[model samples]
Target chain A: MKVTWSRRHVLETDDWSREEIEHVLDTANGMLEVLSRPIRRAPPLRGRTVILFFAEASTRTRVSFELAAKALSADVVNITATGSSVEKGESLLDTARTLEALGGDVLVIRHGSSGAPYFVAQRVGAAVINAGDGAHAHPTQGLLDAYTLRAKLGDLAGKRIVVVGDVLHSRVARSDINALVPLGARVTLSGPPTLLPAAWRCGDLPSGVGYEPDVDRALDGADGVIALRLQRERQEAGLLPSIREYARTWGLTEPRVATMRPGAPVMHPGPMNEGVEIDAAVAHGARSLIEEQVTNGVAVRMALLYLLIAGGEPRLIVGAEPPTSIAGGEPPATPLPTGVV
Target chain B: MTTFDRRALEAAGYLVVPGFIDLHVHLREPGFEDSETIASGARAALRGGFTTVCAMPNTEPAIDSPGLIAELVARAKAANAARVLPVATITRGRKGKELADLVELAAAGAVAFSDDGSPVDDARLFRSALEYARAADRPVLEHPQDLALSARGVMHEGRVSADLGLPGIPAAAEEAAIARDLALAKLSGARLHLQHVSTARSVELVRRAKADGLAVTCEVTPHHLALTDAWVAGDRTVAWEGRPSPRATPFDASTKVNPPLRTEGDVRALWDALADGTIDAIATDHAPHASVKKDVEYDLAAFGISGLETALPLLLGGVDAGWAALDTVIAALTTGPARVLGIDVPDDDWTVVDRAATWIVTAAGLASKGKNTPLLGRELRGRVVMSVVGGDVRYEGDLRAAPLAVR
Candidate 1:
């Protein structure tokens, strides 16, 4: 099915449809094939500039997005909030405007504030990508998680995926539910009652989403599971007791994985709190898609940058003179060669 | 007081009524003067057909002592547009600890006492303030909120906050504080006026407290009665004047008001309370902040909306929308607030409002220094054609041609 790419900002997955999710997964699969090629680069976004403006410290998302932009032959400029004019009290909009003025084509922003990218997108004509926002959304991470699941277990229709831990502060949990639910996956969130209140389960969240306090009950017969990082501050804030207690109670151990359907992939949007949120034994085990999720993260981000920047409407990306126009290539689009990276 | 040109007023064919008395207005002076001052706020109030407005005591230093109260009164007198009665802080610097000298403040012309902007959370301290305020014959207006329950919450906790992914400040945060303060008000037999009441249960609690013969009177803001969280649910974009941009999405900060705009059901309940006389007044709660303070990200932005210019027109539009009867709306603005403040409202002082006149809201049109209202650019019915305060023509919307000729 032919779908028009209209959205200029990839802020959240809430507005994503089933077809959009499938299209992203398919595009990521194509990009995965491109990753295996000898040259491992595409000319679609050849001269475009993609800025990585991260206010928060991130390893996987930053590097993955950087690699994706580089692989597409776009110039990547990385900026951090610390030791910059941002620290000198420059407002978020001012910084964004400055970057746009400096010829930023597509801005992939990871801000500590929720809706920061949306704020920037409204001000500038450049394409905005929300790499991660505070407890709000991480669309690429969600898409990659979904892609890894789809690649592993085939079609995800009617599958149950259990997302465990710190749902209140987990942007991944929000993005995951937004991405997976519409694709016929019944997602159950499991966490300490304080961390995942009943209030988060309501509102615009999908009807297929449910919550269970018992980790075991949530993981029972789960087709997949995504473990969230538990910040130590939760204990200090009295949201939980101790890390040891959390590990014992909610952590994904090998024993807990055994209760799930055989080879039900375990996932974590990384920099994992190994002992606290997930046991290292299960994380590195054959059934865990931890490494595959990371590998697919690059592919998914490549797909996003490609589709959004390269394949996006030309009117959205301001100021950059493209060397090659991806818009010219449409209608029975050329597929990337299917090879393993 | 300057005398009104009665002959000119007659020539204009304007209807006159008592000057509006706003019980809750944040002049933001003595500190955040960049947003509002005594002169700017009084001018804004006058433009809205208000002659008297009770200024909240949540300034930088707070109107805690008789000295500060005297200073505010003096400043308002110099401003000369409206009567800006100072409301003293309940506690020292509004820290919610150590009661201020309420009797001295009252003697110095403080109309009421409130720890607005920050709630007087401590039950004992608040109760003490109530007891002391009873002696002064001034009501203790509480900005009812349990900070513990509303920790880091940016908007009303419900379906909308859930949808927006912003932390929810549950209705219980206001309801719980209201319930406790009402109980304390009853215990002390002190006059208590709840400021900016925003939830359904809050109205219900206030209604019951009043029924139980408690000296409880509450005021709802015009924004609270007209708008819901849906306005802020998404980007909260408004086409505010100035600044080059066509759209201003306060994102989180734009609509980041305290006791955040509640649900539609709560809006309906506020009108119900107003209709049944359960709610006493419609206060503007015209809190203003500089664009630098408000135009930032949601979590970092200050709480408030500059409502002085838009309050009467919006409520009058509300009447057109069938939100309330015109008489009821008029009573809430004038007599209702006058009763809450326990002041003998002068029957002679009034502003002529053209019920048929329509005007679109604009930042340039507002007399207030702060251009931070949500109603900008929206065409609203009802315009204050001429405002007379203390027999002086303070605001004349059409007095453009003749600078000194009152007509």
Candidate 2:
């Protein structure tokens, strides 16, 4: 189906319509086929440049974006704040402009400040993909999680999806709620009062979402679960009494999983604290989709690079004149193999 | 009156009133000249229809000594744009630990004492400062905030901050500090003036203090009177009383300010306070910062709005919408602030305003170097055509040209 995608940047899922989100999921299906192939190379973004500007430390998201760009044959450069000009007090806009001046076509930015990518996207012309700005939106993570859930549960409408732990500080939980509520999934956030503020219960939750401080009650009759990592800094800030108490009360455990509907899947955005937020047994268990989420992360990101750089209309890249310039002679045109059009 | 004077007065939408006096302004001079100098800030004051402005002492080298006060006064005289009054810091270096020499500062032409950027958090030290300031006969202007409650918050705590996932400064932060200061004022029998009072509960506290006959006064900023915390959402329609406009930019750092903008209910409470005489004056709190400070992430950006150039049109818009009486608004700007400083509004100083004149606010059009206003692109309804001070035409012409009488 030819859907008109007018958005040039992916900053947050708050403003995205259900159709736009479904379009990205549909495009990721084709990228999954491409990833499954032995060669795994694509020519859609052959001559484009993708810059990974990670001002914060990350292993999963950074690798996922780099591999996704490489698979599409785009040039990728990585910049971290440790030894770069950012450490010397250079501003985020200056760094983005330097990348833009060097011919970067798409800038993937991750910063410790919330709204850092939105700050850069307003100033630069390059397409910006937010790689988890501070406690703000992580649109691609939300997309991949949605993709994984749809693959397992068939349809998300009217499904009870419980998101557990440190929700006030987790960009993942925010994006998940933003992504799920529109697709008709009833999301309930559960955590301690310090981590899940009472404001979320008093008319602050988005339509079709609820707040439950008790994890057991939230998990009752849930179709799936997404457990967020509880950083130790919350304890340092006097939010939690101790990690052990948090685990004993709010953490997802074997008994907690048994309270859910039978065969309900469990997911976690990774680098989890094994005994803290989720037990190791539940993470590596049969119904866990944590590994599938990492794989789907690459696919979802590849689809984003393709749609944003290729202007959402696949015919423009497949058969019509290519939008971005090709360095070598024009590669032979090939129709997208997975019925993406 | 002369025939020419009468003719000009009879002209459509033109009104001549006493020149405005701003009790709070951060002429970021002795330090941070890249953002604004004393001379440039004075020029901005003249262009904004203010004949007299009290300079805040939060600059670098902290205006704590008589020599710094004399130097600031000298710089303002050299600029010769608007009358600038020096406000000395209550603490020796505005460190909130030790009190500065209030007797010497008051003797050196300091009209007020304040720790404008940081509140005097120490109760014992604050009590001593208030007692000393009373003897010196200068009102202790406080920037009311409990840092512990407002820790690391970038905007107001409410439904908006919850959705944006940013740290929030709850209304309790300001209310708690106000309650403390009012009790201190009652204990010491000293004059207390709060700067940039932002919350509804803060107004109620001040109103109660006034009814109890405590010497308490407070001022509200134009931004807080008109704009709400929703401005951080980048939607102008929700931010103020304006037409539904498209989002200029999302997560704009320009909307970031200290004691961040509160909800619409709070804004309404402020208007009610102003109408009923709970709010003593309308001070600009005209803090300016270089673009380098405001062009970063909203969290990393400095907390202020370059508000000197926009204060008049913003309030006049409120008056036009029947939110406040014109006489009350003008008095809050002119005679009201004059009474706060215990100074006389000079008879010769006047501002000529064209209420029907409309202009769009742009960065390049501003006299102040800081262009960090959330109203950057909106059309404002009034303009100051001329400003007069001490029988001299200090500023005349459209805002495009420099003032005519720079010393």
Strongest candidate by lDDT: 2
Q: Chain A only: TM-score of every candidate?
A: 0.90, 0.92
Per-chain TM-score of chain B, candidate 1? 0.91
How does model 2 fare in lDDT?
A: 0.87
Q: What tier of docking accuracy does candidate 2 attain? A: medium
Model 2 over residues A194-258: C-alpha lDDT tens digits? 88643585657778789888899999989999999999999999999999999999888989998
Q: Which has the greatest TM-score?
A: 2
Tens-place lDDT per residue, model 1, B1-407, is 33566666555555467788999998988998998999999999988888889998888888888888888889999988888889998888888879999899999999899988888888988888899999999998889898999999888876556655678798899999998999999899999999999988999999898889999999999888877786674533221212232334435465778989888789889988999998889998898888888777777778889888888877775676676787898899889988888888865677776665667878888888888867677677677767777777777786433322221
lDDT of each: 0.81, 0.87
Query: Residue B259: error of model 2 in Å?
Result: 1.6
lDDT of each residue in A1-341, candidate 1, tens digit only: 45555556788878777877777787787788768889888667766789999988887789999998988788999898775788788998788779878876789999888778878887777888999988778999889989999888888899999999998888899899889887888899888877874465543344788888899988889998999999999999988889889999999999898888988999999889888899889989978899998889998988788776655332222216552455334312324332211
Instruction: Kindly report which residue pairs in candidate 1 clash with one another.
Output: B17-B350, B253-B298
All candidates: DockQ: 0.34, 0.62
lDDT of 1 at A70: 85
DockQ of 1: 0.34
Off by over 4 Å in 2: A313-341, B1-7, B10-13, B238-242, B399-407
